[model samples]
Target chain A: MITDFTPWQSLGGGALIGLAAVLLMALHGRILGATGILGGVLRFADMDDWRLKAALLVGMAMGPLVLLALTGQTPAVEIPISTLAIVLGGVVVGVGVSYGGGCTSGHGVCGNARFSRRSLVATVTFMVTAFATVYLTRHVMGV
Target chain B: MKLVSALLIAVIFGIGIALSGMMNPAKVLNFFDLAQIGAGTWDPSLAFVMGGALAITIPGYWLVFRRAAPLQAPRFQLPDTKVIDRRLILGSATFGIGWGIAGFCPGGALPALGTGEPEAFLFVAALIGGLLLARALETRGLRSKPAI
Candidate 1:
C-alpha cells in the first residue's frame, strides 16, 4: 500500500504528451508511436527517415536534463524488479509491440484518440493481460 | 524543419512522461497491482495520464484532420490497416504480461535512458533484440497466415 498518488502531475504530464503528439501530427502528419519510432531508429533505413527518428530519440534521452532544469534536480526512477525480470520483460514487450504494431503511446494514446477500433481492442487486450499478470504475480505467486 | 520539429515535440513527450512519474517503474507497477486497491495501496496515476493524454489528443486529432495536409508533410502517415488479426491480439497479450512483470513500457523506458540507469539500457537492448527476432522470423515467413 504505497502512499504516492499523483493525479495532477500525471494529468499535466499526459497533457504534455498529448500536446507533443498533436504537434507532431500537425507538423509531420505522423503518429507519435514510441516503439515504432525506436524501431525505425534501430533499423537502418532511408536517411531522411532515420534522421527524424534519431532526432526524436535524442529528445527522449534529454528528459532527465529537462527535468533537472525545470525541477532543479534529476528525476529519480526506481526499478524494484530483478535485473533478470527486467530483461525478460523487456524482450516480451519488444516482441509484443512488434507483433501488436504499437505500444501505449501509439495504440493507447494516439490510436484511441483517432477512435480506431483496432487500437481500442489492442488497448483492452493489453490492459487485461497486464492486470492478470500483475494479479498472478502479486497475489498468487507472491513474487 | 521537420527534423527540428520532431526533436522538439519528442522533448515535450519526454518531459511529460517524466513529470507524470511514468519514468518510475515501481510507481507504474503499483498501479498494475489491483489487489492493493482494496487495501488502499494501488496507484491510479497511470489512468490519469491516459485520460489527460486522450483529452488533448482526441480534440487535437479532430482539428488536425480538418486540414488537408500537415504543415511540413504532404500527407498524413497514419496506419493503413483496420484489420484486427491474431498477431495483434497475441502481441498485445504478450506485451501486457511483460509490462505487468516490469512496469516499463517503450514510452516510459525510452525517457528512462536519461536517468543513466544501466538497467534501462539493458532492457532497451533486450527489447531491440526481441524486435529483431520478430522481424527475422517474419522475413523467414515464419508468421502464420491470417485467417480470412
Candidate 2:
C-alpha cells in the first residue's frame, strides 16, 4: 500500500534500460537479457561467451558503485519480505526463468520490443501468474 | 570490445533499474498488488518504466534489425523456436509465483545486490541453486529446451 509513484525516475531509468538493450543488440547482436546472461555464465557453454556474460554481471555489480561515485550516495534498496520468503521466491524465479526461457528483461522488454510472438506469450503468462500470486499471498492468505 | 560494451550496457541497465525504484522490493510488490488499484494506492511506476523502455526500444529494434548483422557479432542471435510449449507456460507461471512472493525479478535483484544486503545475496544464491537444480533435471531428461 505504501508505494511511491515516481513517474520521472521510472521513465528515465526505463529509457536507460532500453538504451542498454538497444546497444547490446546493435553492437553485439545479442539480446540484453539479464537472466539469460547469468544462465550463460553458469552454463559455460563456451569460454568466450562465458567471459562476455561475466563482464555484464560485473557491470551490474558496479552500478551502485558508479552511482555512488557520481552522487556520493548509494542507492537505497529495501527488501520487505522475510528470509524464508526471499529464498523460496528466488528458487522459484530461477527455475521458472530457466524453464520459461526468459524473464522480465528478456521477454518483457527486449522480446516485446522486437515483436516476438513467443515473447509476448511468455510475458503475459508471467504477468498473469504474478498477479495471481500476489493476490493470493496478500489478500487470500495474508502471508 | 564485446566484453567492454556488454559491461557498459549492463551498467546502464543496472542504473536504470535502480533509478526506476525497481530495486525496492516493496515498490515492486505494490505494483503487483492490483487490489490496491481500487483503493487508489497502487503505484504505476513499473508500468512507466516499461513504457519508457519501449518508447526507445520499439524504434531501436526496428532500425537495428534492418541491418545484415550487428557491429561485432557475425549474426544476430535471436530466439529461433516459435513453439509455445508447455514448458514455457509452466516455467513462466512458476516464476510469476516467485516474483509475486518477493517482488524481486532477476533484473531488479541484480542492482539490489549493490545495496550490500544479505537478503539480496541469499535470494540470488537460492536463485542460482534453483537454476542448477533445473539444469540437473534437464540433464536427466526431465525438462526440455534450453533457456534463452
Candidate 3:
C-alpha cells in the first residue's frame, strides 16, 4: 500500500489558497478567480484595474513557485495530449466560464462559500460535465 | 477577532491541501480514473484528504453561520434560490465534461500546478477562454434585452 497522506502538507496548501482568496477579496475587493484574473490580463482593459489584476496573477504564479522552492517536488506524469488539444481545452473552459458568469474559484470557493444558489448550480454543472468527459475520453475514445 | 479567525481558518485550509497530496496534479488525475479501473486498486489517499477537509470545514461553517455578523464580509450571504433550472443543468454539464477530459478543475488545478506540470498551464488557459466567451455572450444578451 503506497499511500501518501500528509495532513500538514495538505493543510498548508489549502491555507495558502484560502489566504490568497481572502486577501484578494479584502485588499482588492475582487474574488480570487483564476479564470477571471487571466481573462482580465488577456483583455487588457482600463489602466486602473491593471495593477490589481497584475498583482493577483503574480500571486497565483508565485504561490506554486514558492512551494516548489521550499519542497523541490516536481510532476512525474507526462501529459498524454498534444499542445493543440490542451489549448483547445483551455478555449472550451474559457467559454464555459464566460457563460457561467464565474469560474470554479468564484463559484466553487467564494460564491459557494457564500451559499449562493447560482454558484451551487454552476459548481454542480462543472463537476458533472467533468466526470462525463473524463469517462468518455478514457473509456470510450481511450484518450 | 472575526478577521483574524477567518485568516487562521484559511491557513488551516491551505495546510490540508499540502498534506493531502491534493497539491499534486498526478494524484488528482489518478483519482478521476479510479472508478473506471477499479476502486479496489484505487488510491484512497485523497479520500482521506477530502474527509479531513470536510471534518474541519463542517464545524467551521457551523461556527461562522452561528455568528450575528459575518467575520469577513459586510453581511452574511446565503443562497437565495433553491430552484434548479436549465442554466444550472447546462453549466454543470459543461463544467464536468471539462474536468473529466482535463483531470483538473479550477480550484484543485491551480494549486496542483505548483508542481510545475505543463498540463496545469494548459488547463488554466482553456478555463480563461471559456470564461471570456461567456462574458461576451452575457453582455450581448443584456444589450438586446430592452429591444426585445
DockQ of each: 0.69, 0.81, 0.29
TM-score of 2: 0.97
- Candidate 1 ranges with C-alpha deviation above 4 Å: A1-3, B145-148
Candidate 3 residue lDDT tens string, A1-143 = 22344445444444445554554444334555655555666666666455445555554444445545666853233455556656666666656655455555567666665567777787767766665675677678876
Write candidate 2's Cα lDDT for B3-108 as tens digits. Answer: 8888888899888988887778888888999999899999989999999999999999999999999998898999898988898899989989999998899998
Reference contacts reproduced by model 2: 0.84
Candidate 2 residue spans exceeding 4 A from truth: B143-148
Worst 10 residues of 2 chain A by lDDT: A73-82
Look at candidate 2 and give me any clashing residue pairs: none
lDDT of 1 by residue, A73-141 (tens): 865688878899899999999889988998999999999999999899999999999999989988898
Going through the candidates in order, state the TM-score of chain A alone for each one: 0.95, 0.96, 0.83
Error of 2 at A55 (Å): 0.4
**Model 2: DockQ vs. true structure:** 0.81
